[model samples]
Target: MDEERILERERYQIEQIRQLELEELQVEEVDSDDSDDDSSSENNYRTSGGASASGEFTYDTSLVALHSYLGDVEDTHNRLAFLDGGAVLKLPMFYLEGVVLFPEATLPLRVVQPHFIAAVEQAMTQVEAPYTIGVVRLYRDSPDYRRPPRFAIIGTTAEIRKYCRLEDGSVNVLTRGQQRFRLRRCWIDVEGATYGEVQIIREDSPLRTPREAVGRLAPLLNLRSNIFQKQPLYSPRACRLGDWDGNDSDAMSEESFESELSLHERGLHQSALFSSYHTIHEPTSSEDEKLDPDGEVHQGSSRLDNLLGPLREYNTGRDSAKSALSGNSGNLSFKRMKADKCALDRLREVPRAFWPNWVYHMHDSYTLAQKAADRWKHIVKAPSMDGFVMKPDLLSFHIASKIPVSESLRQELLEIDGISYRLRREIELLESFDRVRCKTCENLIARRSDMLVMSSDGPLGAYVNAHGYVHEVMTLHKANGLAVIGDPVKEHSWFPGYAWSIAECATCGSQMGWLFTATKKKLKPRSFWGIRSSQVADDTR
Candidate 1:
């Protein structure tokens, strides 16, 4: 079937589909069509059969509405899953910030640039009307960009949505998402539009979690909103996940709670909700306390142990925490509301021990813990990220930004087994750089508030200025009246073998901070690093 002929059949189906609309349509649990199979309509690639000879087919949800839902899928418990063995795709990296599919509308896009034009040429020669178009999401501010681009494989699966050409040499076409897919690999074209290989995805079903766990976390979301230090303002309860609008359950309006959630990039807001929940819950513990049935303490050797210990005993058989990962079970090609409900409930019951490792190591752990430990209540408000209000907790964007680290140095960080050692070495070198040490190197301890700290890498981030201070230049060390000097390297109290590191902005060569060094002998529990000349432009600013 050719692209134009298939589109003509789609046009006919749209009319019949409207008349056949029901309260809710049956979307195959996970719509997957793999060409490697028999090339049937039920798979990824098909030579024929999506349409009938009379040009009649089923009408599903509009692409636009589907796209809206994709954006709003909140609660990590409800995310879609990766699809394996589907038709493979090769296309230019979509540069558009984002693209939406409008069910019946056959969109016309120009394919002018060389590599993309070649992609179209290849597609034209294929047997299917359209092979497959992967619509991925992008974060770009090309004209006056503040940061490097962020691309994620969270796009819908679309068969050939439609195709048309104008008098111009560009390919005019309509593309639609048939299902969501992941980017297998991304590489730039000779002309620079990013391109990649992608695999189609299918929505997952409800995950398993202990019933007692849900019971433990749910009401507690409201009970001592302030004390669950392990959870932050962005947690579900803080965002009124505990007191969600009843109408939102099945509501289909533009402003329904679910719709609003699905549309927004929620991590930052979830962070806020975790913050808000703590304001109301005044609990005694800062850590996510776990309880064993026999009332014995469960200080496991590792996190997975602590998380699974009590649950394993309670759920000895098949009926265990089946709710923990419903969100990942592949669907017929779509997900259900009931499954999402189960997943959310399981998240509530997750033991502090079971939480992901990143939670323990995050930079904001202590601040979040302090919010929960104090159980200090603030306003119970669900602030949406539509306006993006809070200051970013960590120095993000700096990860990929060109720091002093060379390609080999950066690769070492990537390959390192011990995260702390990598950081310590990087800090030591930064502290020793010539440009890093300034007049402020002396009296570092005296100037505390302005310095940055990393405590235990702990629950509250207790230490300050640990990374960027010119410690040796500062005079906390007592200066004896002994002028018996030899080599400056061995004699100077402040001098380590190397220099300190200075942090300068990559976009503009302005100084951000200085990273101080600490060897085993110099390891004081409380030493910190300092921010140097604040002449650099911070995106946050």
Candidate 2:
């Protein structure tokens, strides 16, 4: 069986390689035809700029030659069958620095190391969910020198979308993150490849707009249901970032619910504050318009609050007395503040059936989703976001993945297991992401308004170099605190119309990113900067 599997895998790879070569040929033919028309436009643009300072910088030399990226395909057909089963899975682990993959995000990787290549081969031959691996961030605990690297417990599993084997025995693989997992334990196999026992993290159902508020949110929700008609309603048990295959509840074992039970016990929802009070008033149609739109159904009228306000004060006084019996006010106050922050970080395990009349509508998932999407539209450019807004849960991941925030902030988004909480935090980041600075020395690089959208993906994009290193960089129209090294090199440029030069921090002398100058006179922005995300810090509160 092993021998047959190996032969079968080899045959499959050969066929895929051939298909990629054919596609490359087709792309080259199309580019060649387009270049003739573009050359004339380039001449006109240079002539039009005549004698200006920017025009004087135009080069007579042609634009950088474009390189065809081979074997790039979106492979979303392969469903992860084990996720819905609630079973512990063992998968090969790949660690990267400053990378946190979210479901549905594309991650292009080049494998040259011997052990890693072997690990990929093993994944290809697996009987179940072949070509899947756990991708986790490997980072040091502190800035202290020479500290050992540690892999994060939370990670996303990536499925190899397409791959090409080079003559040098290296592999260039395009993969997409499929689902999030918790790394329970890790070990090195006999072949020196790392593997981990992982559990699928079941994310909570997204907090949706209540029926009463559905009409109020009609403008935003108009394009929601019809667009997702073909897609299945989200199931908590369904594998993320893929089509749902209806899973039976019986498939889950008792052990699968253990973590959920513990999680529910720890949550303190707003309703819990007055759970014993049974005086909630249900407003009729006549009174509906008088209802405080921000509050839930049980909070439709002030009767609920009028009955419990004094009781809450009494309980607070009693709790204060209990605290008075324990410690000094200063220490007690500080501890309480710390506890509140910690609780806010986690998802509410037990959802509130109804919130108090004083609660704000900003806490609603639909409201937060609209706010996040609106903010994103103003800052970044991408495809239509209508579908993303339809599913607030997926919108959070999509925004988190493409946002130009630092890796620390990106990792925090991945760790957040709740939808509404994630959206709220993202909105806060979008509002405060004003400046970009060097991570090591805190030197200012650029402002949020200076961001340039060069790639259709977004402002920040991942490009893999010839050396197999994937750099996630954000393009900007202007940058400061950097020195360029060596002459601009056009060879192997990720942007065909630009030549890139190595840029370093002027103050700290660390490599910040690259400065890309237009090789053709026609390219707009004559020059721009591609700052590496790993090397920069952002205002991420």
Candidate 3:
């Protein structure tokens, strides 16, 4: 019996040795494959004319080039099935605080938690669909509260585009947001990883306005152009050597020209000239009497002259002065009024179905996307606007992701599934952000142009507090209608080396933002404002 047992043990040891050898061989083969991949990539880079002596490949900076690169990255992930109303999917959940991931937006993460690492590994090993996870924002009443986090009902599906495991067993991953889903049920497993059963949210169908409505809306293109055009609305005129009509022969004497030029330089020549011309050309009473056959004015004229002669003369002088100062102001005002009336008439003539098309023509994907890209460029100090994804839904989500607003507001935007509705909301938000004001009093607070983006991300940023809750902030260099509430306190401030004080709107006495004062005197501005973007009123209407 002892000899049989010994033989069995020897056989077991031999099997173990064979298994170890196989693992070592597999490791060696993997290392060799990695080296081959590296070599192939280097050769491809060189062939593409991107190689350098420093061993770094050059990349294109244009938006078109960026879009192509991102498209390739997206193609690597498993394509998700088209979402329908009743479709249900069980996915691993990644809960985040003060973060809302929008579709088509890329989110980079460094995962170190053990449970999360396991979840990623499990996801990677899935046979049916790998590289997909559910992401939802966690919510708590306060930052310092210690309780099981409540997650948002709406969540986005994220596809892992790139991932690498580090020596310390942590993972760095880049993920792209996909379709939105609603959490039906969620539970924490024994290993502390959360899993959710979610139903896919159906996206709104694409709708276009009728051709006639589009024609009506065509005028709006010019309106948009006028709003967004980079050139000055009124060009400033420079002094010229010729006469006003550009005829050298008709030019005034040097002394008169100098007087006129001086007035022009002071921006008062036209008004003064118009007033003097009207005064010198006043009609005589004898000429007026000759025109009247009965030598008597009509009753209407007599009444009007008696009632409004003084007022009319006063207004004529004032209006003449203004008209001369701004020669095109009246014309422009008249055109604007006509345009508005025309728009209203057209709107009334068109059917309700045509309104959607009208909106589409005015806020086309390209136009809105370009506007969004321009905003990002302005915020990030980039050379030019980035290429926008072709899909309208994706484009809207992309803009929402980049906008510097509160997390709650962004989450609210994410919850809306209609493409047109989402785009309209984004447009409104963008327009309103151009000017910040108090919600209650309608007093101007700050200009969006004066916004200071302090985050490494876009203008909006999330800061985790001591208790692990996150707060989103939008920073600004200046504001109005706000008064500091108390002395600055440095404890638990979001900005390091800075103290903060509660600030309220001076007009309405409503809470607005915080006054962040530098703790160190060397900071350029001694103080600045960090307003809650959600609290600002949407005055675009």
Candidate 4:
């Protein structure tokens, strides 16, 4: 009777999935047909070079405008424009410290420096190109901080979306990161305005099928599955696997049922679904039982246990010999070897042709965008993820922007162009971000869900100090080991009426962040904390 019920549930799930797939196909077919008609019409207009009776431009004014502003904006705007990979283009440059922009993310700037103000003005008035500037980070360790400070090579092109001139002559501008680029050469004009000749970094072709990506992420999925299994609350089979009376039927709605079933299916497939693509076979029941009960493998060890035992042992032996020769006495003598390199290489070698057809299928199967958006919603303390955009690149950049990590690590993520690679890295980061710790004392600080994105731009909040240096901070709702110093001072507070007190990590006696308390009785929550992203350790790194 139980077997029949399980089989019936599976059939029901498959039927529902098939229905959803069919609906998606219909939508795509309609979109494709409409796009074809529009393209044909556009071709006709281009050939005629005149306006149509229906008010459509025969001469491609938008294309002409894009070309006039930036030589080839139409070609590069939405799509991965570079076919052969990189191209050199001269563009106005803006330098910032401890901030890296990602594509589709927004960066807000308070332009006070004369050179930057001039750059913004130049961008605004330029008739040929759209208002765009190249953003590069100015590292403090660089030799020159005043005259064209040493900047990072990898940067992003930002399009000025909005700008306003303040009474003090400073400019407040909002810019959206468009694409990643590598700064090849930079020069400063006599007026101190900087210019960079940058090569646009092309993104990887979105050809990996959902199956292929899932296959690549098999180990991680399996690990997550095991974790979910251990935690009954998160486990999909938690209710079903236990004794349940029919009275619980009132609690199971269609949406909840679908979500549970989906999670359950994902768990089941994680262990064995991707095994056929690689040399390693599925583990036996006894071996599975013998695996780590906590579901965690050692650093640099394959999740599949003996999958690369020979290579790992060889590396282990080499490290042991080195340690013996050096007279090292601790387990630290064993350097963790990268066990995922072989797997990553294999994934990269998968035929590109297998991806394009599978792309939509994967999107339909896994719902990456929706899942990511939901996670972001919780992280940002938002009511819903509805306002968030859902494209892979956009979602990835959005999460990267809001994640409370050091600027250096964010910069590393910004430098990575491959969509899948970035998404995978982000997923790993998100997982670790759940429990933030102090870098100095490794004390537990904030949880990922406790993060509050107070700023519109990203997680990092910018504040100009009295001395005029801008500092970026990440806001958190709660933390541990923090001691508030003195009374909260309201003067020069960024949030206007709210007062702040210096907060230090109690364990190490190092400054961690600030505790802001509401002075007005109306303000809810009463108090919160803003931790410097630099002070937190990036476990992903």
Task: Give a tens-digit lDDT track for model 2, residues 1-541.
Answer: 9958965765565454334333311101112322222213321211011101223333211111111243333333455554652557888888888788888887877788887787787887777668899899877766675888888888999988666678899887777788888889998899988888888888766655442332111111112222223332121121111111222332322234223333333122222423423333232233211212222224433644443343334334445656766763432344554443343222122222234322435556777788888888876645445568878888888888888878878888999977878898898888889898898899777788778766656677667777777777777767766666665676556665566778877778778788776555454556778888878774653
Rank list by lDDT: 2, 4, 3, 1
Candidate 4's residue-wise lDDT over 1-541, tens digit each?
9958965764564453333223311101112322212323321210111111122212111111111111111111222232235766777898887577777766667678888888878766555345878988766543244655457899988888656677777766656778888998888877677888888887764433454344222112112223222542222232222111223333323345335334444444323323433463343324431213332223343444444343344345556657766896534334433333344345333432213444544443225555566665655544244454446666666667666787767887888766666666766665556666777678777667566544444555545443334455787655666665655665555543346677777678667778766554433344567787656766543
lDDT per residue (tens digit) for residues 178-212 in model 3: 88899999887777767889988888643342232
What is the overall TM-score of model 1 with all chains considered together?
0.25
The prediction achieving the highest lDDT against the true structure is 2
**Candidate 4 weakest lDDT stretch, 10 residues:** 64-73
lDDT of 2 at 335: 52
lDDT of 1: 0.31
Report the lDDT tens digits of candidate 1 across residue range 168-200: 555544443344455788787665545678765
- TM-score ranking of the models: 2, 4, 3, 1
Q: Candidates' lDDT values, in order?
A: 0.31, 0.61, 0.53, 0.54
Error of 2 at 286 (Å): 34
User: Scored by Cα lDDT, where does model 3 land?
Assistant: 0.53
